[model samples]
Target: MIDKRLRVVLAEDSVVLRDGMVELLGARGCEVVAATGTAPELLAAVAAHRPDVAVVDIRMPPTHTDEGIRAAVDIRARTPEVGILVFSQHVETVWASRLLADGTAGVGYLLKERVARTSEFVDALRRVADGGTALDPAVVTQLLRGGQRHKVDALTPREYEVLELMAQGHSNRSIATLFAVSERAVEKHVAAVFAKFGLRATDTDNRRVKAVLTYLAESGS
Candidate 1:
């Protein structure tokens, strides 16, 4: 169940790949409202169409180093409601951190390889468009193993488990189910995590995103 048609704007430098993506999205019932190769075009298309989601490539046109990422960040700032899914060949933890720094909801960073599996890729897009997250597990592993744990060293082992799952974009309920613990207990641990990180719990703020950002910040990822 896809309730409504998901509109998308795609940014990819490769013509072949871009065409393929358009076809794929169309087959999956997503309307490719606009597709562009350069970051500027992508941004403009997003502004014009205001699509439900934007599928961005990490490298596109000109320098191809971080143009897509820069565009993704811009889109996030300009249209918080529009989802962004970074599809990149390289797994740059720093870039992923920048994307999720503000929050993880309505955001996703998946390796380009994941697009090979049509169903999985489409599902990831849907998840992001629905104000959820879909971070690559490898991205999480890279951040954890990158050796930036001075602040995180203070967390208890159980807290570390909770944080890791959170970084993987799991909800509190999902984490509780995985640990087979009461949701209330999970809430306590999550609260403790926020306290340890010195993040204020407010109804207007997303504590989960802040907590994960703290994890990335500590790891310098």
Candidate 2:
């Protein structure tokens, strides 16, 4: 079940946009406790108010080379309970990887274009607040290359497809149906993928997620 309207803190350099965001979020029943620009201010706002989630823009004043990412990482380290949503106008997989490294729920790296739809943006915020990782589909595709590793390139083409679909949250049976294969065969392909990545599929469901994330990391690397 979803929790109560989340307490949020936003970080964006644009005055007009930030004010609009606060109003939008407030209408959706979210309590925006703090708002600021710059990395240090963001870190400070989160620390002072302790919001349930943080929405940060990648670029801000003074050497915006991933300052938001660093601030978000620090916030995550200091306050693991707080969810983080990072938006960027450009593809920045380097920062994306840092936010996703923990595999913890309630973290996202969404492209700014995806936020034009008020409902979609609010959904992303709610997803993060509820401990779900909702990485933008585009970000997922872009970051897939960083997941590449020495041996991961050896995975069969179909296996790679399986991994991608799995990352999209499809089950073995679902994948099998999509590919017109038996569930048993799908399971075997999944196993082969795990073995190729040297990942343990011990927990069944968790293994699928792990394998997909691993493949993304390797392919992107």
Candidate 3:
């Protein structure tokens, strides 16, 4: 269950789907501050409401192609604080890479059909709203398959595992629990991954996101 109530702006073109989502979010204790059918409307609603998170679709009015994702990119640029969760039927890695280009927090990409449970969907949304990642496993797989192996060759097997889990938006503590290791061990692996990727501590950028971006870019996603 979500720890706190979240205000949301939903952007899905289908009336049926949009209504269903609004109801679903309401049931899950998220207020749908605005529900829109077009990219422009979505952007306007987001700006007006300043919702905690925006659930966006990839296609909408006009061309019915990439308008939603473009609006999402704009939202990221304009309001870095509001989280964005790209809930789409398609898995366009190019779009995913573009959305995460800066690798700032509060971003997620999940395939609609693959989100079989409402709890899972809400959990992903909550994670993104909390400035964490929630990438779909399929999205992760495609990125890994397309990445150039040589780029990540420097990572030891364990470090590579940590990187993969990191790509999936797992926290260091979560990774430790999954591996049955101490959190400190996980931190060491994460630091190692950062060093290997040439990422350094900086106030302006999130090193974790940079590491993930490097993984995505090197994977050729």
Candidate 4:
């Protein structure tokens, strides 16, 4: 099902793990374009090669905190075509959603433990590279804490789907296609969602982005 060879950029702080991933993916039929262990390297390597996907560790470089997540965000903004598969020790739902919180071109958040399942891990890379979405089991588990009501109260099931896609910065046309509706219908739903969230302002984009960010912040997802 993979149409073309996938190019991967990997960033993990552990030398051994980074090397192992590079080898594992390469053996699995992906091209390992570059690899690094620092946040700066992640940014620079991604900028330089613009690979098809980036597999980044959640912690890296200075502080080894959210550097990989932050790098993934910046990389997403710069290289929209590149998919980012974030590897984390813990289920960082907020950051994971934030990474996917804009344009669904190619985004994934997987925990490190899953790497042993080579088939599944490579499948995730392919899905992301092919414009699909994948989230770690743990990530989804964490998101469940937000509960259905967090969005269900303010949006129709369909509109809530649109809203979550919108949270990923998907456009009206994209959301429309996802829901098998017209752009106009998507617009209407968006309007209603804005109204429900009190985000129907001239600063719609900013407010909407902030609203989702607030939701994620509050729910820790």
Top candidate by lDDT: 3
Candidate 4 on 1-221: residue-level lDDT in tens?
55577898889999998898889888888998888989889899988988888888887878877888888888888888888888778666667666655544467777776657788889988888776666654565565454333543666887777777865657889888888889999888878777776664663245555455434443444
Q: Model 1: per-residue lDDT, tens digit, 18-124? A: 99999989989999999899999999999999999999998878997989988998999889989999988887666666777676878888887755688889999
Q: Judging by lDDT, tell me the better candidate of 2 and 3.
A: 3
Q: Which residue segments of model 1 deviate by more than 4 Å?
A: 145-189, 195-210, 213-221
Model 2 local distance difference test score: 0.77
Instruction: Return whichever of 1 and 2 wins on lDDT.
Output: 1
At residue 123, candidate 4 shows an lDDT of 94
What TM-score goes with each of the models?
0.72, 0.69, 0.73, 0.72
Q: Taking the tens digit of each residue's C-alpha lDDT, what string does model 3 give over 16-72? A: 999999999999999999999999999999989999999999989999989999999
State in Å the error of residue 181, model 4: 5.9
User: How far is 199's C-alpha from truth in model 4 (Å)?
Assistant: 9.3
- Error in Å for residue 216 of model 2: 8.8
Sort the candidates on lDDT, descending order: 3, 1, 2, 4
If candidate 4 were superposed on the true structure by all CA atoms, what would the RMSD be? 4.8
lDDT digits (tens) for residues 1-221 of candidate 2? 33587899999988898999899888888999988878899999999999989999888878867888888888888998899998778778776766665563668777887667877888888877777666765677676564445555778999889877776556789899999989999999888988887766453345554565665455541
